[model samples]
Target chain A: MMRPTNTWFAEKLGDHGIYTQYMEDHHPAHMPCLEIRLLDWQQAAEIALRLEMRLVAVWATEGGCHDQPDSMFAYMGLAHPEHRHVLLRTQLGRERREIASISRHYIAACRMERHMQDMLGITVSDIPDGRRWIKHEHWPEDALPLRSEFAATTRMAQAEGSYPYVSSNSEAVCQIAVGPVHAGIIEPGHFRFLTVGEMILNMEERLGYVHKGIEKAMCGKTAAAGIRLAARISGDASVGHSWAFAHACEYAAGIRPPRRASYLRGILCERERMANHIGDIGAICNDAAFSFMHAQMQRLREDMARMHKQLFGHRLLMDTLIPGGVSIDLDQRGCRLLSEQTRMLAAEVEHLRTIYADHPSIQQRVIGSGIVSVNEARDIGLLGYVGRASGNYADERIEEAYPPYNELEVHVPQGRHGDVATRVWARFEEIADSARMIIRLLEQLPEGAVSNAWQAPEAGTSGFSAVESWRGEIACWLRFGDHGLIDRFFVRDPSVINWLGLELAVRDVPVPDFPLNNKSFNCSYSGNDL
Target chain B: MLKLLKQIIMTGDKSEPLPDSDAIELLGEQLHAHIRKHFAGSLAIRAVDAGSCNGCELEIHATGNCYYDLERFGCHFVASPRHADMLLVTGPVTRNMATAVKMTFAAMPQPAFVVAVGDCASGCGVFEPDHYAIAGAVNDIIPVHASIRGCPPEPADIIRGILQVIARRAA
Candidate 1:
């Protein structure tokens, strides 16, 4: 694979008349970061859009201290060609702490830009939707949680005013507001639907009901302690988020975990993927009122979770991946047990797939319901199963190939139709694929220590890492300050993009089918709210 | 249809016996008696996520699966608080969700019991108390009769916690 080198950035960016000053590649991972003038930020976005690069993440940082003047820096992480990532950085003067919106180029940056506005008090000018993303009037208008001086312990009184949801003036249209407290045993999110009788005209989602100030909580914590918070960012994606955070810290410190640990991390990640996929496959069916498939799938999922607990001491695989490497190892007995279980799962999943395909009732509910066109999917830059089901293939495992994945064979499934049925099929294929990967990992288990000693990186060192979690790519960036404490941390979960996919897919569908469509996407509330 | 029937027959009755059934029954002669008397031999629960990481919700969902089969004990999850005899709440109760949690608790009928699940709901867990976004644990927002303590309590532990709440009400 030909990676985009630092010099390559200078040559390519210079052609667009955009001046670039390349920063030293201090981080172990070879991610090329370029510093550009704030005026050229929109130009950079245009170039990235022309190159068909996805805007991976956007964040703002307050880089000031007692000695230096207060300044704000905005960063945009873009997906580059050949499994590489390029970060564009520009410093903003404190007097005019504002940046132009890049959502004009990347639709996926809409919510992320709004989120930076809410958390850091940075103004994103000229965005289509200027509504607050994560803020809900719970704090003072001036209080920005991510600002350097905003105390974490400051509690505030709640203020009142409904979110300015986009509404239509048609008298025939009826509006239905749901959630923040749903009927199901699920996370909290508000969804507003404008409908006439049964068909949905428009669907708007207002999330962040599960926001617990995770980024604000992560500041000043040690790298080891940060992993615990990262793991809990979204419970089901613990392995992916924690591993990404740990990888970032390790990259900054210039330490590579042992081969055995990397192998174990890979196996654990696949197991997490298999668990979530199995649960979701059943859930989608359940939402379609197929109780038989739901019950059976839940049974299979529960059994797999039990196996995980027997092997790694946690059903959800939380706190398993730490800063240096994995915290748990499997002996020969565990390996044999896992292999046997994998065989059972593969056969059972194949049988279930046949039943799901043959059932006419399930087909009627999912075949053409809640479709996201390929163009909309590409525009939103969806990832993981949702992206693959919609003809957008962006799996970090195959593209980035970090650690054990580079040594393994990855088969990423692709689908042309972006409907509920295709999403379910994508999950089934991914489960089988993950099972195969897990078995391969166990067979070729390496011999070495599972973890290495952690060393503190020098102050001001920053690092970034991206991992293909079950849902999608989880990208993490962090910097170390004095005394080895974390100066700043920002993470982007794939749900931020896929949630837009859900909103797009639900248009013109019956309101009754919203559950099925939502289950098919299964975007994480906490992951996005953070 | 034939394959479906065959598949069902082959799977058989997978609802396993409740974990620690003997001990629960011994203490829950009160619980069974309470359900039989007050709830007419059925317990209706409405689960609320105050502001959890959703780890606790997964365990609660598992209790509804085939192996746990929580309905066998005359306990079932209800979609509305108005129909609930108990409220199963989770998490540190963030500022954004605190009002919803209160409204949910207020909607339930009289003699309703609340079981705070997970260490986060019980006492803020790994999160800092009274942080800018967090309003504190479940108890700080509303009165909690029973609390289960764990990063995320297992399904079996959730059952035990729910039973403990009911048994106390029975007594």
Candidate 2:
């Protein structure tokens, strides 16, 4: 039984130098989540781990109070779902920029810790692999990217060092390296595979090949422009990432979007989810060599894209999402058209889904291939579809329901098999549910102006906003500076965590099934790299 | 099988068939005829993603669907650059991906027709080429023939641009 409340944990954390000092309760927006300060990072993390608090995101920010100028802040975004979002904060002294690694307790903290090390010059004291995670040779030897001192236009001498991928000299195993440039028209990412014949012994990924310095680039941009940058972080889930950014902007600004605006945002979010899921389902079938299913699903996807173009004026619905609210609005005719299209898609998908479900080839290709066991999924603490497929049953939509979703009944179907087949089936089930959401949203079209005006927040204050993206949970921690320009920005994409799941899933799988397993998860390279 | 045939007939090949007339001396038509005369209308294309947001890739893929059916016009996507006749590159070349893009271009056979698809490849999109992280666009990294400028050109525009690249190569 998974406990949802952290109230008991508060008692367990009793007087650990984490002050009971005043709290900011984000009650109406979310749960009565407390924002607390901690003095001992190591002790607090160990106690929280003992008390069973899931470590969600570890984001580090540079700079402090003007009097205490050399201070660095590290905030761990932890969640218990039913209770609240507990933002645990710890500060590091100026002289010793090193913090003890929490990656020992929680495996998800390694990437974020190394990210802090690479970008902000904050060292994680002792672990194992000390390879450069993000800052490549293109950056100068002593350049700290996220610090206020570093210039935005700093590019060092050309990249000088080659990545030292771990090697195995065993006679039985052989090494194979693929991409940063792949066959498909996809983003760049490197995969190093050690295989015994066709069976993959281990698969390690060296991503961040598409690192665009997105957070670094957001240094001086206004909140509106920062949303645009966020959208580009992951092209496939632009709406999800941008919406999370917008939510953070609104919260930090202390303004509420109207009911109509929230409803519009929900519609946009669900539509985005449906589009990506549909694409994934089609691509999965294609990888399984069932080209007919791919063709059918692709046709349905095209139909939906055309509908988006007609209604929202973009095939991919990239723009039209801004800081305050949606930039575009829909009328009655658009609603009627969307409703009819959803019915058509629902019926068509149902017919095609049966063909896929009963089909022998798809079943043969996917069943028991690239399985992540319940224990592994639990220990790794995967989120979204990857977690649900393994029976982890953490749906942020149900857990942290924001606005219109809080009103509607979001059906989160759980999966058990934890194989490629289970993942594909999960997408189909989720798509069907999203179709109903679309119809409901269109039918109950709330009336009011879509966009709202919001004022900027006071300087030096930060806000954390979370949204359940199609892939999984996406969160953004944002701080406002002078003239409402972005001060410090950090985002935790679902893909960043799920990419680890793929590495673990592919251990015993054959070389050929890699494509299928990869598509089953369909993690975004751009999203993870950023 | 019978139902499938009937469905195909009902769909009735929605593609608007373009004329293969030699009398029409437009650049694309001439290239189409010239390719037909030389390589029997076969054009193998290799697409390079130099850090695009993937909006262009989606439209590029839609061309493979039944509506456009780029394969019908003898335009096929090949896996390796060595086998490709033209390179359709997208996005502003990022500092990390710059080497991969250059290697991909270098691996292509000589007389390769490179079409800088989308405005990003020409260094003028939301992703600027002059940024510290971005090295430059496709042209700044490698030689290009035709610059097809659209944030993400529609499928029709991509098809037309490929034809224009073939014409440029034939010239």
Candidate 3:
């Protein structure tokens, strides 16, 4: 990256006569990799957006500012190329703990803002949807789980009544409600479909059924222990979340892991991305009644999962990431194994790609079904494969220029159709791309110590980090308490934003096609709910 | 089509060794003698996720795929609880899902069995006792016939647990 600069803040905000304070590399070495700045509280979103800066994540923490009655800190992470984030600090306080919502300006701020309000009891005024986002009736009225003062053993109130889902009143439109429990072996999410016969008019989803108080439970736990919680936030994307958490700790403690460790982490991340993508491509085909691809894809996934367990010590690669670097290291045999497997898998995937293109039955099922246009995808700020499929290059590896990535010539696969066919094609292309990257990583395995004994970060300091997961961007924002334990831990699983894509893609498709659409996006309920 | 046929011929015997005949025999005889006499040689299971990490859910799906082939064990996952002979629930019972868990349990016919799979459903796993969202453990919401404990139990472990429930009833 370029040497850190502070002039951009003044260049953008100077016209408003808004006071600006900037810090270079203010966060830890691997943190949300942003320079720090203080913006006028009211214009946080406006100032960042005016500079054409991309919004990464928005999070709030209960920390110092004791004199400002009922005050809590709200941080907005923004990205401006070659680097990743610029944390804009704003306070929500004065006894009310309320702030003007930025949801009207940035659509991504919608769910995250509602999450803050629901979990922290921070009232966000002018929020587009003021209704309970993360809170069901089970949360006791007085229990704001994320606050510093809340007890760990606070009892949940009895959940009561049904959710108030907004519905459109129209002539001859019927409603079909499905799940918190589904027919398939999957996590819980409720989908309400408004249909005129088989064609979908509108679809709305109600999630957070699996909110296990991940943020609340991690509080007071040491950073080492907190990594387990992060890994479990979304089991499928365990490596992504854990690395993000580890990077945040590394950042906060000012520890830069050795180059070898960074390369190993990159391998872990790409392996995760490939496994999910391969399985999803098969699953999307299965949803369209092409069962062979499903079986073959899953078969390939099972092999990958087996390899992960053999080398990394867990089926899902859960807990493979520790604070300073990876907990597991690969030897010569492991490197040879990865090399051979990548060769075999690439050939198999190439064979399937040809079959997918030539087989009319499969092509018919995938090509035109479940389309989410590019404009709609960008408006919500999609990331990773989903964003790439919609012609958006928001991959953090490229945009953030994180170590190892900057040194290597990384090729990001992109597509433009934004339909089931393109999504599947996008995932297939990603798998091939990842195979090439993994092969490269294995051949270039740097020689050094795999990890270091992690030093605890100072108390009262926090860090922000984002890693591109199989689905999209996984952001973790955290702080340490006085005893080197987690003070405030917040995770924004990419599924939290990508869930909206399901709503858009399912519209205009027949009722049966909804499953195909859902599978193509493959938003995880556990990830979003957490 | 020729490639598919050749591959099938080349990759022979994909199935695993069946469990001990004693367990299967006991399972068969037990159903023949006691609970639900008319139902013989087969079982219908409905999987419920009170609140879980979805790690367990993935393993459970693997059990049904060709490698593990759970259906060969005379068990099949059904869509609705009303038609199910047993319930396989995962995750710590979140408050939002507790009522639905109860409703699913109540809907099952008499002599229904509940198999609480994964450490989360059995003992609340890494999650603690009192958190606002989770109620902790599947047993807290419904009576459990068996508990399978793992961060995410292996598919083999899950299949064995389902059989153990029948063996227990037989004894």
Number of the top lDDT candidate? 1
Q: What is the TM-score of chain A alone in each candidate?
A: 0.97, 0.94, 0.94
Worst 10 residues of 2 chain A by lDDT: A20-29
The superposed Cα distance between candidate 3 and the true structure at residue A342, in angstroms, equals 2.4
Interface RMSD, every prediction, one decimal place: 0.7, 1.9, 1.4
Alpha-carbon shift of residue A296 in model 2 (angstroms): 1.1
Give the clashing pairs for model 3.
A28-A251, A29-A251, A32-A464
Root mean square deviation (Cα) for candidate 3? 3.0
Task: At residue A241, give the lDDT of candidate 2.
Answer: 90
**What is the per-residue lDDT of model 1 for residues A28-59, given as tens digits with 9 covering 90 to 100?**
43576678999999889988888888889988
- Candidate 3: tens digits of C-alpha lDDT, residues A227-321: 98888888888888898888777776767777788889889988998888887888788887878777777777777877887898887889888
Worst 10 residues of 3 chain B by lDDT: B29-38
DockQ metric, candidate 2: 0.52
The DockQ-based CAPRI class assigned to model 2 is medium
- What lDDT tens digits, residue by residue, belong to model 2 across residues A396-474? 6787777778788998778878999899888888888888998998888789988789677767656677788888888
What is residue A408's positional error in candidate 2, in angstroms? 0.6
Residue pairs whose backbone atoms clash in candidate 2: none
lDDT of 2 at A272: 80
**Candidate 1, overall lDDT?**
0.87
On DockQ, the candidate that comes out on top is: 1
